[model samples]
Target: MTTTDTTATGLAHGWYALSLLHGRIEAHIERALQSGHDLSVREYSLLDVLSHQHNDEGGHLRMNQVADAVVLSQSATTRLVTRLEDRGLLSRYLCATDRRGIYTDVTDAGLALLAEARPTHDAALREALDRANEDPRLTPLVAAVEKLDGGPKAS
Candidate 1:
């Protein structure tokens, strides 16, 4: 029915607002990434995770760990990793210490791609926030989102 009518049902209003905000932001970011970098949101997310884990010696994470961090199913994560590996964005290697464990690490190409996509992602998020600010009803929801540490900031 009406917005007020929905809110009268209790805290469902806040949850609904958050879900709406999440969906809008996700769609905007997905579009921006796809058009600007030819990368899907999940692909970018996986690369982002690996990038953050990068270090002097080259950081890596187990497939299960990556799946958990990205909130994807194990099979889905494996497929995503395979795609990235095929694109030369990342590599999967058997762990020397534990043969059964495989580590996925970002390749130089992935880092460069991530560097390129960072601006687009940041701009999309900022635009979403700006649009949210335009709607008085979204003020609190936006504030809550702003407080969370989503990930690496765009430089």
Candidate 2:
């Protein structure tokens, strides 16, 4: 059975339900992040991803990795980085060891914004998940999301 398969045959119903859940959560988070932080979902996500970087070896992420983490294309990622840099929220510098590679990192302002927005993001997420959990269609998915047990491990 594939994701497109119907409820009687496969996972289309589940797949769509998950999509709806994601959309709702993202929308809610976006509104919260925007109204409170003046940042878009992608921007906030980029800041959050960059905030995870460190000074240790391999702690830095290349642009492609950043793009992949934020679910944006490389060009789109570069554009986003530029926008944030203009706002003093992010900075791009050449890799110390690899001149050909550029690294993007959260600026002090970016980290500050991310720290402030983290609570809003978490609250919005919990609120959205809670609301979705009330829906019969999404209840199981919510449980699955909150569950501690990892998916079946490979032998």
Candidate 3:
């Protein structure tokens, strides 16, 4: 299904079609992620952030930072983390200097989950990339997206 043919399908139109397409892809991947790794896609994304946090000292990242990275609200992120912690997938630590500040880190179990999920995740990503590459218009579309990314900062 092409995005340009907005009215071609009876059930889809323009942005609705785009959103539906996105939803379908996400649902497929989400189910696969949960069944294969015992982790949701959102959980995997959060774990990814934590794994990268090792360079930031304490092997942790602030909850807010993780929420932004995962595109989830603070409350939603908190709930997800709590669930993962209950499953022994991760741990949340309170910052010593600021009692109100919280950081999250991936536990050994979480790392294992990530390791198990990597292959499935990679395969899904590769499939999406292949689909994109098969479209002749993608080259110009990618060029437009790159241009819209803007150049270096103004000094």
Candidate 4:
């Protein structure tokens, strides 16, 4: 059935539209980053978090903290971090004060990759968003997306 028919049958149209928009945007960004930089969106997001944490916790975060920040389960975060570590993008270190805790820090290579991926990711997102905004039916949803992005609303 068509989306309009589903919406007419009592589906929440706004949420359905938002979900579709989110998936499309995510897929676009994922593909762009993967083809351009050999990075997944999750990996890029993890590196971005690390790159911005230089002033806090000595530029490192406990594995649990990284998991929380990245919205991944601890095990998933560990696996992802391990993969990045294997690639020399990040390192895991034993915490000096707390033997039970391990910290993850971005390596120089991670920073370099993030630097290269940032522009590609940003351009892909902007292109996808602009395409979404071009759809007249998505006007309100586009405005909501922009507001969430801290951008000025279209009048």
Best-performing candidate as measured by lDDT:
2
User: Against the true structure, whose TM-score is highest?
Assistant: 2
- Residues 1-155, candidate 1, lDDT per residue (tens digit)? 88887778657777788788888888999999999999989999999998878544536677888999998999999999999899999988887778997888889999999999999999998899878867777888888778885779989
TM-scores of all predicted structures: 0.84, 0.88, 0.69, 0.81
What tens-digit string does per-residue lDDT give for candidate 3 at 114-142?
88898898676545534544555344433
Error of 3 at 120 (Å): 0.9
Candidate 2 — which residues are off by over 4 angstroms? 1-9, 148-155
Clashes of each: 0, 0, 0, 0
lDDT of model 3, residue 16: 60
Weakest ten-residue segment in model 4 by summed lDDT: 51-60
Compose the digit string of candidate 2's lDDT tens values, residues 1-155: 65555455546677889999989999999999999999999999999899989899999999999999999999999999999999999998999898999999898989999999999998998899999999999999888887855559679
Per-model C-alpha lDDT, please? Answer: 0.87, 0.92, 0.73, 0.86
Clashing pairs in 4: none
- By descending lDDT, how would the candidates be arranged? 2, 1, 4, 3
Query: After TM-score superposition, what is the CA distance of residue 96 in candidate 2 from its true location, in Å?
Result: 1.3
lDDT of 4 at 130: 85
Clashing pairs in 3: none
